[model samples]
Target: MKAWEIQESFGISHLVQVERPDPTPGPYEVVVKMTAMSLNYRDLMMVTGRYNPRQPLPLVPLSDGVGEVISVGAEVTQVQPGDRVAGCFFEHWTCGKPSREALKSSQGGPADGMLMTHKIIHENGVVHVPAYLSDEEAATLPCAAVTAWNALFTEGNLRPGETVLCLGTGGVSVFAAQLALAVGARPIVTSSSDEKLTKLQALGISAGDCINYRNTPDWEESVLSLTDGVGVDHILEVGGAGTLEKSLACVRFGGNIYQIGILAGVTKDMSVIPILRNRVRVQGIYVGDRQSFDAMNAGIAQTKIQPVIDRVFDFEEAPEAFTHIEAAAHVGKICIRV
Candidate 1:
């Protein structure tokens, strides 16, 4: 089997194609023929050696993938041959409390990921993709969509008629905006590009009001203005350290802020006075567990929410897909056909 591997902990350029023996499933595992995989910001961090330092060398490089079951091992009955399935990002986190052990387990790290021609996944970690979605669409659900789902519903408890603020037009933000709308909550999406905002409007998203963050660096005030000085009910914070303060400013008193990503520089400092004054709850979100993933898939089936895919690359163009994401040029999911 051909898989993309990071030859060394250098950068994206270090990613190289390598041949590995095709894997056979253990008694509780199933082997899948990968159809598609999607990229996430963490993948970039892993490539650059900026994520967890414990990540092993020569690691397989993606956590989100969808495939069809080709063969099953002895005790595997969760899925059979020909069933479409997507592997969980946190392979060991089936449900309940996430411990350090579960957090350490993931595909595309010391554990093999699905960026190859075939992947073997433990039956417990594989979830059936929504019947309505194609392989390309289903591939985007594992990490990005699940993270958005956890951020909005699990952490924020966003309600209908409440206003939610999503920063940037990344995969998580886009999915969060759509989910908010599906639940009757209003979404305010910010972008550096006006053109993208127009496209979002065409998709029936009012966007509350679009702010060109590049133009107005203090866009938090704009969010305040839109909320009639009350601030938004929830904020999906993707910018991490760089945007945390502004996110605090834009959230309403007693509101929740889901901190999901750190696309900007990592280290940050903030005064606790604002959080104390507003009584805000800040929650850090991992991708989520199987139950949450299943709930998100159900919502996708019910609403038929289409993911915004910026581009698709051939299997051979996987490196280019990574490059596109690293450049921050894509508006939504960047997929690779395998």
Candidate 2:
């Protein structure tokens, strides 16, 4: 088996590919031959040693991937050889509330991830993928797509005809937009680039529904205007402290703000007045459990939703893929064909 590792140091240039003995499955385990992988902002941070400086070195660094089941242990009955599956971000989080034990099983950082030609995982840690999606598309689901689904549907309880405010054109935001459209909800997406905003229009978002944040600095006010002063029913707030104030200002009373990331900044001197005043519900969403992943796959299969992939690199170009994501130029997910 071959895999890329962040050996001895953290940085994209330091990623080194090496070989290891192929894995054998234990009882209740399965061996998957990875076909594709995708990049997330967290993956870039992990490689650069910013996500968790205490994380051990020589880690395989990607949480999202899809593969074919080449072998299974004697007791494994959830899936069989030749089945297509996507690895779960948190291998032990099968259902219900997350716990310390479940958090320890998170892939691509604290644990070895699926960046290799072959990976051995518990049968409970992988989900059957939608039949209609290509390997590259299905590979983007583990982290970003599941987080979006958990935020919007599982926690937010997004209803049809309600408005959703997507912060940017990143994987989670774009997936939230697509999922919103799939369920008959309205999506208003904001981007720093007009070019990216134009590209989003092709993905079912209309020009009137897109906001160029560079041109409209007070985009939250624009969101309010678009909603006829009532404000949106749900918000995918990825910008943390730097944008939370504005997010609070635009979300309707009793509306849900699913906090999924801290892309802007982790700390800021912001008021929490609106939170209580407006009776808003701000929930922090981690990636989600296996039951939710299964439900999301079912929706994707029924709706024929296609994940937005910006680029695909060859297996040997893994380091280049990391560099590309570090540049933050992609409109959506960046993938690697393993």
Candidate 3:
């Protein structure tokens, strides 16, 4: 089997293609032949040494991909040889709360990930993709989609007619918007690019609901104005310390702020007074578990929500995929055909 690895260094330029022996399934294991893979911002950070500078070297770095089961151990019953599946972000996190042990099982960093021609996953770590989705679409589910799902449904407990503030046009944000629409909730999206904001209409965002952050630096005011000074009920806060202050200002009293990303620097001087004064709930969301993934798939199957793909790169152009994501020009998910 062939795979891409971060060989003895951390950068897109350091990624090298190499050959590895095909893996065979052990008891309760499944071997999948990867068909398509998707890029997450975390993947870019891991490669560039920003996510975890201490992460081990020579690692296959991606948590999202879809493949056909080519083999299964005798004890495996969850999936068969011909079933299409996507690997879980945390191989051992099947249900319930996360723990230190479960966190260690995360792929693409401490564990070897799904950036190869074939991968061996525990039978419990793979979930069947929705029948309606294409392989490329299914590949985008493991991380970003599940994170958005966990934030809105599992943590936020979002109700219909409530307003959701999506930080950007990234995968998780877009997924949240689609999910919000599916549940009869309203979503207001923000992007630095007006073109991207215009493109969001295809996903059901209205021209008035989209905010160009570049033009409106204090976009939190816009959010409050749109909601008639009550503020949004939920916020997908991806900008980390850089935007958390603004998020605090715009979220309604007792609203939920699901912190999922740190795209805009990890550290900054900020006050915690607003959090207490507003009685807001700030939760840190790390993807999700298999139970949540299953629930999300069920919802997707029902809603027939198609994942937005900005571009698809050939297997040989894997490095270019990283480059494209770093440029941040995409409004949706970026994929690679394996």
Better of 1 and 3 by lDDT: 3
Residue 74 of model 3: what lDDT? 91
What ranking of all candidate models by lDDT puts the best one first? 3, 2, 1
* Candidate 1 global lDDT: 0.87
**Model 2 alpha-carbon miss at residue 310, Å:** 0.2
RMSD of 1: 1.2
lDDT of each: 0.87, 0.93, 0.94
State the local distance difference test value for candidate 3: 0.94
TM-score of each: 0.97, 0.99, 0.99
Query: In angstroms, how far off is 261's CA in candidate 2?
Result: 0.5
- Residue 125 of model 2 has an lDDT of 98
lDDT of 2 by residue, 1-338 (tens): 99999999888889999999999999999999999999999998899999999998889999988999999999999999999999999999999988999999988989999789999989999999999999999999999999999999999888999999999899999999999999999999999999998999998887998998889999999999999999999999988888899999999999999988989989999888999999999999999999999999999999999999999999999999998887777888999998
Off by over 4 Å in 3: none
Say which prediction, candidate 1 or candidate 2, comes out ahead on lDDT.
Answer: 2
